[model samples]
Target: MNKRGKVVRDTNAGTGLISIDGQQFPFELEGMWKSDVAPCVNMVVEVDFGADGRVASVQVVPESQLAREQAEAAMRATKDKGAALGKEMVARFGAGTLAGMAALVCGWFVFNTITVQIAAGYSSGLSFWKVLGVLNSPLGFMNALGGAGGGSGAYGLFAVLALCGPLLPFFVRNPLAHLANLLPLLFIAAVCAIGYFGLMDGLKQAQGAALAFGGRQAAAMAAEMASGMMKEALRAVSFGLGAYLSVLASLYFAGRGAIKYLSSRA
Candidate 1:
């Protein structure tokens, strides 16, 4: 029989003891040693036993080979565990989560929700993720913080919350996941609110300047012109197909969560 274990005593040129499954066996270097890897104390080896129950031959296990085997074993265990966990999540959450995830991913990849028009005559569209990127940038960050650093940080905060929507579904059993999915709608509303207020502020400023310098006639004309321009701007920035899909995904999650929560309560 061949057994694998480590050497408890070094036998570089003479006899020493090795442990194989709690049994120590005596080995000699003259004939028993059979590998290029030097037999040192604590080195793992395969021990071939003789009919007399003594160590017949000992071959050292290479460190590289041992490490490779250990790594492969760990990888296999992780793969199996991950597969089991995925199956469990699928079973627990059913297709609701999968569908929601698919829709949410599609929404993230589709048409942008915000449009930026430059005086240079070109315009750009931005999705929620891109908006988050802009918010995180130095220039955008400074602009978001405003002149006195007193601007509402709620936009970035809500955006961060909205980004977490997809991750919440992984909880499998948490009812709070419904709230996470709904964050997208809130974020969308927030963006729209910001745009609306910005347009209104611009309208107010134009009217105020016209009234102060150009009299009632100018103020009335400015108000009329600004109102039309505001409507055009709103059309330019109206919610894209992506926003609609994201809303649908949020609604799905909400409906699923409500049913699940009620069922659990009953």
Candidate 2:
């Protein structure tokens, strides 16, 4: 009769390992049992093999153990995927990608602020240094997030999305072009969501700022400014979304029109 226990050690080298139950045996020549064996620091396994002079097949069993092994396998698979994605991001973006993204965001913020300053009756005479100071305000958070460089988990997601972004063309020709045309709408939606959340945060911050300043007049003025800014941000985001959708719809229809025109010519 066969007996089973966890493998305490592989005392027999390649031939077979000794189970904790003191059963000495030779595993199958095909090594089917070896593939099923998982070596952890102290993983428990239920082994089954008949002892005989001839080589015998050993199976690690316990019907319930199947689920445990599968769960371990799943964990390994996820770990491997995350590692592969991290490696890919390092290859594509290099170590300096974070710094580059920070610079890009800072530059965008500065340009937009300068545009706003000119529109708000501020003399176009603010020195470059003054503009730089304004840019520094938003840079704090943006730099932190961009510097984090999308951790291993987020990099895994980015890698998957990036791979899919390129592959879309195989099923739909000119997918890159199509995606570029569509991205404005996506960007707008993202901005709208960001604006909505930003409004909530700003409102909370405004209440805090009001309490900090004290005096009903000061609080009312701060609240009014916050509300005005929120409304403007929301309006801009909504208008941007509508315009982006309009452009995307026109571009999509135009592409269809071109295809139809060419098919008729052919």
Q: Which is the leading candidate under lDDT?
A: 1
Segments of candidate 1 deviating more than 4 angstroms: 1-3, 48-54, 98-152, 156-187, 214-245, 254-266
Name the runs in model 2 displaced over 4 angstroms: 1-137, 140-184, 212-218, 228-266
Q: 186, model 2: CA deviation in Å?
A: 3.1
Q: Write the per-residue lDDT of candidate 2 for residues 1-266, one digit (tens) a residue.
A: 44445554442345445455565444432553544554332334444444543334445565577789789999999999999997886676454433333333333222222222223443232121223232234333333233321122432343234323322422565423334323323433443465467558868777777878786787788888888886774443212222333334434434543554456456
Q: Model 1: what TM-score?
A: 0.60
Q: After superposition, how far is residue 129 of candidate 2 from its true place, in Å?
A: 23
Q: Candidate 2 clash total?
A: 0
RMSD of each: 6.5, 16.7
Candidate 2 is scored at a TM of 0.27
Highest-scoring model, TM-score? 1
Per-model TM against the reference: 0.60, 0.27
